[model samples]
Target: MPRIPLVDVKAQYAPLLPELKQRIAEVLEEGTFVLGPNVAAFEREAADYLGVPETIGVGNGTDAIVLVLNALEIGRGDEVICPAFTFYATAEAIVRTGATPVFADIDAATLNLDPADVAERITPRTKAIMPVHLFGRPAPLAELSKLGLPLIEDAAQAFGSPAVARAGVASTFSFYPTKNLFAIGDGGLVAVTDPELGERVRMLRFHGSRDKVTFEYVGTNSRLDELQAAALRLFLPRLDGWNAARREAVGRYAELGLGELCDLPTDEPGHVYHLCVARSAERDRLRAALTEAGIGSAQYYLPPLHLQPALRYLGYREGDLPETERAAAENFSVPLWAGIGAEQQERVVQVIRAAARVPAAS
Candidate 1:
């Protein structure tokens, strides 16, 4: 079999090339390279798609979180509770604001922050709860809301999930090349339910100025540029179709018996399957097997945020978050992308089943 990539980004954009290039050319011709018309149009389109009143385009996903945090006045002495079973940027964003990140364990089934666990981690100084829609699975926002802390969704992987797409006080998205909704390069946005807060985040993404010349608060330069925004505009209308295709691929994984051999991610109506992650006690061995077959695979959050060297000062030990630790030791993502063919999926499943020595489901 030919080498199967974990994400065939080229395949996704191949058919869209003519239009994409035209969009890029328009940006180049206009010479409004930064915070121009395309960015403005994309922000409005994304805001409408997300069903939020406003969306502020920024340079990247990390900046989206930092800008939102700054707008909320959460820093220095406050704490932001989030899961340790996620990417480094989740916690890193909190620490960047001079606030301590209070790491919580994730739900074994969904790999999102366990709200019950979040409640236990909260304190008088806990300013907000940042629940990641990890791997595009919407965290339990309805449950998390009852805890009475502000919810700032780390929605980097969950662009098309409408259920939680507009639920929180604010949600952040990354338009990284591989995301469900993506740009040619880095870009991001913040969706806010409150237009007032949206304006604050908007100003913060620039130099904290409503009109660029009048600086109201000290801020950073993180504006989403015209070129990237133009690419995103081309991709935006097709986002739902691509997400649905990803869901279809995930269903195909189950039909091929991948689910029986490994713990497949729980399928929610909103899950876009950003990556079809599966868990097995023999994960390392399975990853090795996939590699031997020239098939791609990866482990998500191997170190788990709390155990990362940079965050060790938070005093988390090896066994602190049992479920998160176990997940870090076992989760492996199989090859999955929009429009992935059945033959490739079957090849991936065969490799995984062989590596685990598991029989196909009856």
Candidate 2:
């Protein structure tokens, strides 16, 4: 087998090259690079797709979180509870708001913020709960909502997920090159049902200005540029199709009969398989075998956020989160992407089986 990438970003653009290039050329010819009509049109499309009243485009995902939190007045000594097993962005956003990020343990199966565990962590200072839809499955939104704190969703990994019954006060998404809904460069949005909340995100992304010259809330510049917005538009129409492909690829992985040998992701509705993670006692061995076979694999969050060096000041030691620590130690993802073919998936199974020393079910 030849080399496989975790995701082929260039391959993603190739099928839609003509449309993508035409869009970019139009934007270039018009010379309205920043905060242009393309961005406005894309925002409207995103809102419609998300079933929300408004979607505010921004420079990046982190800024989307910052803007929403700022608009919600969740800064300066507020506490935002989130999972410790997710990407650092979740906690980093909370800290940037001058709020304490109270890390909670995740559900072992879903790898999402565990609602039961969260109840124990709430305090008088706890103002919000940020549940990451880790692995593109909706977080336990209904269970989390019963806690009665404001919910801010980190839907960065969940662009094409099936709809959840409930929504948070705000939800943010990333359009980084590798996401389900990707862009050529950094792009992001804050989606909201409330018109008032939508307006706050819109103003916050543009230096807190209702108009270009006037400043309203001491906000920063986080506008999504014309190129990224244009690129996103080209890809937007194909997002669901690509996600369906990803789902099919994961199904192929399961059909290889590898589940008995490793912990495979289940067929959960709303799961877009952002990473088709599997667990093994032989995690490192499987990863090494994939590397030797010229197949790509990854440990998406190997350390878990609380153990990261930057957050040591929070005083969380090892063994603090048992499920999170166990997950960090045992899971790795296979190369599952929109364009991955069955032959390639078979090769991946070959490598993993070799590492696990398991005979293929004959």
Candidate 3:
């Protein structure tokens, strides 16, 4: 293992282990495995926390998007506008619903969907707009709302962001292990302000049955299991605190003068800093230097989705999305996690300084 990892899940969960174990034990003793009381209780707590009317727990984040599309009745011959620079699952979910994903350019600074670009991409077939809170920076939801289309927020990276999950027509979250609010295993949810839409999502997650016997919309099986839901209940209350720690770590990186070596992610109050991404013309060199120093690092979305061989048929060429391509080529993520020490951040900056031939921080 590296001296520091990109995210230390073990460290994040260590403090909660005893509580988590007790929760798991209770789940086992209850004999309510799938979509049980724990799942319902978690859904209520999460919905309350997000200030939404309801939340429907599902199998994973990708399914949450698909469920919302199905609930909205968006399907074949429909178009959903989204950013191409995000995780492939965003577009993949749209395609899975038989809707074409219209790619839009992202803002250069926030690395989120540019509302202006989204306006240019709109058409009569545009049924919805999906904006990702990329790297925990809230997307321009207020501007996107003016487009007069349904807004579905892909908030997988930004569970604790202020005013994020509340703005969209519906929002999706992933409780993957690395997330600020995480479960021991995969879990996801869809938050909706509309109770009718919430009921539709709830039914869709459980094989389209309001009751087990009657199938309504031909929905797939995607319920969040009791074990995962129980674990999430333990973590949800602490999400804001964890997000604060992540923000603090980003501030420490800035103080260590890592920003002098490369462009650090913008320090937005709402940004939870899921990944402490930095942009350098020398990203490859910087990553290599960190690797040699026994540190963990990573690069995100190198092909920028539009240029991926799988997406070539979208008729997008190399330069179609300039900002997205630039980000893909220049971005690298360094070690970041809740409770990371200042010394660790300083060491990371020292390696970065050497790689970029910059003076050390005083």
Reference-based TM-score of each model: 0.98, 0.97, 0.97
Angstrom error at residue 19, model 3 = 1.5
Model 1, span 198-277: residue lDDT tens: 99998888889998689999889999999999999999999899999999899899898788898888788688788888
Candidate 1 residue pairs in backbone clash: none
lDDT of 2 by residue, 29-94 (tens): 999999899899999998788888889999998988889999999998899999888889989988
lDDT per prediction? 0.91, 0.86, 0.89
Q: Going through the candidates in order, what is the number of backbone clashes in each?
A: 0, 0, 0
Question: What digit string (tens of lDDT, one per residue) describes model 3 on residues 282-332?
Answer: 888889999999988999888988888887877999999999999999889
| Candidate 3 lDDT for residue 339 | 87
Better of 1 and 3 by lDDT: 1
Better of 1 and 2 by lDDT: 1
lDDT, model 1, position 288: 97
How would you order the candidates by lDDT, starting with the best?
1, 3, 2
Model 2, position 201, has a per-residue lDDT of 86
